[model samples]
Target: MDFDALRRHPDLEAPGLAAADAADRLILDESASALAEVAGPPGSVVVIDDAYGALALGAMDAGARGVRVHQDPVTGERALAENAERLGLAVDERPAALPLGAGLLAGARVVLMRLPRSLDRLDEVAGLIATHASTDVRVFAGGRLKHMSLAMNDVLGRWFERVDVTHARQKSRVLVASGPRQGPASDWPRSARDDELGIEVVAHGGVFAGTGVDIGTRFLLGVLGDAVPDAATAVDLACGSGVVAAWLARERPRLVVRASDRSAAAAASAPLTAVANGVGERVEVTRADGLEHLPDASERLVVLNPPFHSDAAVHTGIATHLFAEAARVLAPGGELWCVWNSHLRYRPLLERIVGPTRQVARNPKFTVTASARRAASPLS
Candidate 1:
């Protein structure tokens, strides 16, 4: 398969990573039967966490009839759609990311995936495949050796009777597993009480930071005690697990809140977090890309703890793009509350991109800043 034909979304750029990686090729090469299954009938093969269009398009190129695919990032899904149209290929795309179930896996004899970094995520996926896919299902999971670990083997072993590792090729390797064994039902969407906040934090396996609140967010929350503007509507941009959004809704009962993220798991888990905190009715969660759909200067407040990494690559553009979008959607006197690692030095950039930025609070590691949508004067 000519994997180089694939391309990442135009909006995303990571320094070391290309449009397609060697693991994608290794996966397609190692799973001949699976590729054939995808070409022969629908639901015989399913692809998960494909970074772009590589796996699905590669299957189509190999004469696959119908390939069902799920991508965790909005950019990846859009890139796949764009590539499919560019290549004139038809792919049976899932409506959302990682919607693991019988509809996606039923009668599927083969599962192809580019392994995710989170072992918890892999655990959930492996369990789902073993439980929902055909009893004869064979899973081909591949990734870079640096990203792969013995723990993945252990995780897959929990759900499959056999897990074997292939020799490394081009810095990538595949884990071949079969003999699906029935396991207990999923333990995801788990919730735990937050004693300090007097609410619950709910999370799925794939959510960012995890079930507990991270220190960066915790610090941001501490500063937000009196920071969130009094407004009719506010957004928790890139809301992971919806802790901030739920808190905002509870703090201001009248404010309608929107919690959004690029990951389907995060978006799906947000509402649960809200409901767990008794604010579900006021908090609206969505899987979206950077609040791009909101009209110009329509939002009175926005809060963000933008992710610093893109996939495994440390990329600041992700945060910068969100800042631009926040500036666009925020009303004239609106505020964009942001928290980031102190070392990233985002205040200057924030001032330039949005408007005047002032430090609200800072810890040794994180610095919280609130920038106005359009200040009286732009920062020099």
Candidate 2:
């Protein structure tokens, strides 16, 4: 959406104030508004992340030098730069992008954040904030009231000295936190084990199946080890936190593994996971919708644990699009290995797109399937 559109849209204003204060800074999300209010006019340096770019832009408009840390190379880089330039704000020389726990914010004064959907990853960010921020730093966080959990408040309280909530504006509330003094950091234990894989997988709070590896992914991994025939180039479509691609790279050191996801947060975390697991040199991660940016027939194997949700609702269109993209990007004799909920009815769709799809394995929760792209038509 255009900047003018974002500013003028009623959805961007506080709930009751939209009509009365249309000319006021329009915040796209509730957390952003609360952050803007608590930070109280960003001075000197203002730190923001992908979730609250609009709020950052608002702060920049109000005379703050906004520094945005984005994980997604595509949207993150483009949006932050373009938005800052649009508002006639200066960009800082410090790194424009950072992984979730890279300890980059050593001297940030005011941090404005929008709570990410992945709660476990949020804890990691909290730990980093606790370690790096000084006592007087003001951290303003916000989210929809529906999404705010007491557990999150408790976690924030542990990291900051005092925490308070703003009244609901547009069905969303902002959290105000004062830092400088925080509880000692503690390590959360890993729950899943794959001794052969050599990775200790742990989930902190809000990751999907954070306590253990996902059953569908486990099934897919089993089939992948057997089905892939000397794969030299591989792509892990929807590579959340790089677990699948990391495992793939560890299993086949000679293969080039590429991981990608649509979420900016996932893109940031995936590369870190790869590097932490000693596969960073071999794995490349990017943020893109499906396989939009990759060339045709570029990879030998494309593994996917396709998602079934769009926002909060379950839908099949995402899986369908992923299959179409996989078919488009696989070379002749290239394979697409995918795991899906067994009840999702993907077998027929796979056959329609890739032709002659076959079931590779099955478990109570999911089905592993494989397909080879059909030979080109004679006309081509």
Candidate 3:
């Protein structure tokens, strides 16, 4: 159905909230029937994030007195707030809009979560919920049928009560869970290693290469140690679990290393990695959409492993935006170093934005490129 038709349909309004991108594919539904089957009403505190806003709105419409909606601090904060206003509900004043980690669910009675597309991060969310949710709390999670996997169900069952599947409707299915509270937070097994760059790296589940350091990152770290200039400020752009940023701080203890990601969970996990490695004082973690919050020309070095796929789709929009933003925020002569899939075309984009891009290193699967801000360029 088209967005216009969905907006005009009276039945769609029954969800108490409706969301559609330009495509209008019923992005989310939080109707009374849906919420009733998932989480019962009255005094329950309902929490929804991203596409799950419709469900939270439905619960509110179905007589839920308190509802807290979480959005990834990096991307969904604005949209979630706008969604709340659209439904005529007051936004929560607490720091409840960020990612709903274990700390955020301390008092939630019921949670209706829309599973994210990144399966790598699911364990982190499950671990958080398991740690915080009471035994009596009901956690109902749903996703498109195609995205649901046996492993996903297994992960949910490990942390929550019994897991039961609901019939698919509108191409989505729900996993209903209830049980005794099991709060052992051993979700992500840690593997520690001292890299060649004088940094001790500890990785957890969901962090890229959580099982072991990715060869691409290890290659980039080696290059960074050799090429990084003596600068006061640097940033690890897509810092997955704080490996590169923590390494930078360990190698150059006086330099301020800032780490950022679009995932609130990644940002939350980064500082812990830094603290574990004893470089917490030198590292600052921010949840951001690529350089959005950084001042123009503020950093002398920007290191990244630009992601090619957002969820399951192969897209370069994020990498393109990061290059543009990196160029904008780099000090004159500042360097942008990035590693990407060898098949992905990023060199031209880097050249167009940062000027005189060069290949620093390459492996069978990935290529590392470096570009320096032009001192006399228009961007400068």
lDDT winner: 1
Computed on alpha carbons, the lDDT of every model, listed in order, comes to 0.83, 0.64, 0.67
Question: Tens-digit lDDT track for model 1 on 84-114?
Answer: 7777654444222346566777777878898
Weakest 10 consecutive residues of candidate 2 by summed lDDT: 17-26
Q: Which candidate leads the pack in TM-score?
A: 1
Sort order, TM-score high to low? 1, 3, 2
Summarize candidate 3's per-residue lDDT along 173-207 as a digit string, tens digits.
77766673466665453646664555555554456
lDDT, candidate 2, 98-199, per-residue tens: 544434456666666665555665676667777776546667666666666877777777777788776667666667677645567645423455665566
Q: What pairs collide in candidate 1?
A: 39-64, 39-65
Off by over 4 Å in 1: 90-98, 375-380
